[model samples]
Target: MKVAIVGAGLTGSLLACFLARRGLTVTLYERRPDPRVAQVERGRSINLAISERGLNALRKIGLVDEVMADALPMKGRMIHPVTGALDFQAYSASGDRAINSISRGALNNALLTAAVAADGVSVEFEHRLVELDSAVGRMVFATPAGKVSVEADVVLGADGAGSAVREQLLAEGIVAENVDFLDYGYKELSIPAVDGEFALDPGALHIWPRGTSMMIALPNPDKSFTCTLFWPAGSFDALTSASGIEDHFRINYPDLLPLAPNLVDDYLNNPVGVLGTVHTLPWQAHGRTALLGDAAHAIVPFYGQGANCAFEDVVELDRCLDDTGGSWARALPLFEARRRENTEAIAEMALANFVEMRDKVASPVFRLQKQIEHTLERLLPGTYVSRYELVSFSTTPYAEVQHRVHRQHQLLGAAAVAAAGVLFAVTRSRARR
Candidate 1:
């Protein structure tokens, strides 16, 4: 079968590797020049937290060791409060499990290299998808040389949140696309290594949660930290000058001012990226072309599962193909059916996590609740699992995990009410006696 994958991104390149390994002829069409030859883009997150879900996918293709060799393990969130107090929250009750922090460019390069080395895989850079006819499995690409048309047995749109293939599908009335943009945006900044050593703890994801806005820093292999500032839409515009930028940080993030020397420059130069969720219905068109990853469902970065989720899509698609005996017609629909519910669950969780990361994590009550949850997890073993644990440490289906967490919360609430009633009755009896 001839497979055409649009985007040549992390998901697309990885999908190409999977298909090629199955003896299918795969060609990856990328709008951008090959990352192998071009400069890396600046706007996207420099580092991503890869959990067990993403690791399992890489393991399937035997690339886990290579990709994770240089990744930094983040065991938990290191909350840095404004009052000069630091609090640590372990992700797992056992305290040993961790998520890996890896460079986005490096990981994409690894997958691209793996796909290219496969027996039947090729990549065509500068071939941007302009049109697609899923009914005929035909595609048109706008290339640097000229417009090119091709026929395929299967076409996968791994393009991204702003996918051209998806646009074509919407134009054909095969699916519906809905994008919800957040009033908040994000900008990337750097905390370079100070004198050949990390400026902060390398084993934790550092967070500065300031109620309405937040800043997070993940360690890089080079010993520096990639800090992302999530702020209100007009917040960046308010900091117009170098003095204004300095004053803003000094007031809101006093400690970060000295740590990030280039903060002012980054604030002045870097673009503020929009945050949002993308929802699409009927991800497959005519059971021959389909969307995956961010193209199908793009959520905010609060949960750090965007890339992980995308990688899982590739793995699930491969499984569906195996189940259908390599028939694209059966596999595409199966892939969409099995994936939509899970993607929706993750999207909701990701949006909820933004609030937790930005405000709740710094609250005393929330911290105490986390401690209790950790204690329960340790005491009950398999019976109690935190939402973070289920999302990051296990390969449990996302929708199942969300449901389980909701049920757990309800059970805990009922138990608390029962305990309160018992205490009240005992107090009344003691007073009467």
Candidate 2:
């Protein structure tokens, strides 16, 4: 049986590698020229944080070590307050667990190489998927010579947020998709290494919290850090002029202005990235075509789980294929039926985390709550673990993880009330004496 996978990005390439290993003939199509040979896009970050979910996918095809060779480990979040000293909050209770920072372009190229090396896999660069006919199991690609058609027994769309195959599948009455955009957008900035050394804390994910808006920096292997500025869309345009940009930074992020000499230039020139939540329904198309990765569900990057979660789709798809004995007709729908709830659960959690990261993380009461939550995670290892831990470190299903975290929070509230009562009773007896 021949399977046609669309979009040779991370998911598509990895899926190709797994399918080919099972002796299935797979043809991977990508619109852009070979990224390895072409100029890499400057907008998106060159690297991403590959946690457990992503690493599990890469481990399936023995490419985990190759990807990790250049990755940097980030142990925790480094909170930089407007006033006072910076604080380090370890992600794992033991402080040993970490998420790896890897170059996105490099990883994609690596997967493509691995897929091409497989016996039954063939990759075609510059084969833009122009049209997909789900009913007939056929695809039409706009190639250099002109339009080319290929017949397939099954097709999978690993295309990203803007997916052509998904649009076609919806037309065929297989899927429904909705997108909600966050009013706040993001823009990229850079802090180059100083004298070939990291300018900031290399062991943590640094953040500059400015109340309503915030800036975060993630370290790269090259000793540089990529800073992402999250602000209201309309607020950013007001700083178009040089003086306006300078004045805005001076007031909002006074600390960053001096450290980044060309802050204004980078802010004005860098593209404003649109943040949105893509809620897609019924990710399978009657066994002929199915959507994986971002094509099925795309969440905002506030949780830093976007890429990692996409990598997870690859691993899950491989499992589905194996369990169904290579019969995609049964595997695709079962995959969607099982993975859908978890994907949507994380999508909602990711949105909630935006509020936690940007506003709540700085709140005193919220910080106390986090402390209590961390304590519970430490006290009850098997019974209770933070949602972040399950998503980033363990293989627990996202929906189950979220459910348990909520229950644990209730217990924490009761504990706080009892402790307060004990303190009040002790104080009253001392006053009577």
Candidate 3:
């Protein structure tokens, strides 16, 4: 079958490689110029923290080692409070598992390279998808040359958020798309290396938690850190004047003020990215055209799972095809039905994580509670596991992870109540004496 895949980002390029490996002719259409040659898109976050879910997909094509070569291993979250010592929350008790911080552009370029190296995959750059005919499995693109229509037996929309294929599908009455935008938005900031050395610990994800806003930094290969600042939409406008801008950071993220030398320029120049959850019904359009990755679901990046989950989609769809004999008619619908619940659960959890990350992390009581939870996980072995571990480590579906976390919490509550009763009895005996 001839397949057309849109958006040569991570998911699109990876999916093209998988399909091409299966002996299908694949044409990848990307709207942007070839990313390797063109200057990197300014204001976008450069790196991503990839874990097991995303690594598994890269491993399929034997590109895991190649991809991990430049990765910076972050063993845990390093919280940078406005004042005081940094608190390190260990991700693994044994320090074995780690989320690799790698450049997003590098990963995409690697995948694009892998796809182009494959036998049957071809990429068409500077081609913007304008429309699609799902019934006939044809995609129309407005190229630099002219308008061109490419016919295929199958077309996969691996496009990113704001997908043209998803829009076309909605226009054709094949799917319904709804977006739930968060009130909070994010902007990019940077911390260049101090004297050619990383200013903070390079082995952890750095976070500066403010009650209403937060600043996070992930390490890059260049010994610098990319800091992302989150705030309410239009809140930054309050900091328009030079003094206001400096005062805002001083009050909320005092430590960052000294570390970021180019803070003012970055604040004035950087773009603020909107966060949203996308809901779509029936990702498949009559079995001829189907949506994958962000085209089907665009989620917020709180849990750092947006890119990871998208890569996992390519893996799942490939599995579904394997089980269904490569018949997209059966595979597409089944993939949608099976993956929808999982994605929805993760979407809710990711939002909840944002609250914990920004506000709760700064609370002392909340830190003690986490210590208690960590102790239980260490003692109970198989009986206890953290919500983060289940979501990031185990191959269990996202829906199942939520279920397991609730059950584990219930057990922990029961144990706590019994211990409280014992303490009360002992206290009464001591009082009688």
Best by TM-score: 1
- Please give the range of 10 consecutive residues that has the lowest summed lDDT in model 2: 40-49
Error of 1 at 274 (Å): 1.2
Poorest 10 consecutive residues by lDDT, candidate 1: 36-45
State the lDDT of candidate 1 residue by residue for 138-204, as single tens digits: 9999998999999998899999999998999999999898899999999999999999999999999
> All candidates' TM-scores?
0.98, 0.94, 0.96
Clashing pairs in model 3?
Answer: none
lDDT of 3 by residue, 361-413 (tens): 87888778778777777888867778888777766789999999898778778
Q: After superposition, how far is residue 95 of candidate 2 from its true place, in Å?
A: 2.1
Top-lDDT candidate index: 1
Better of 1 and 3 by TM-score: 1
Query: For candidate 1, what is the TM-score?
Result: 0.98
lDDT against true structure, model 1: 0.93
Lowest summed lDDT over 10 consecutive residues: which window, candidate 3? Answer: 89-98
By TM-score rank, best first, the candidates go 1, 3, 2
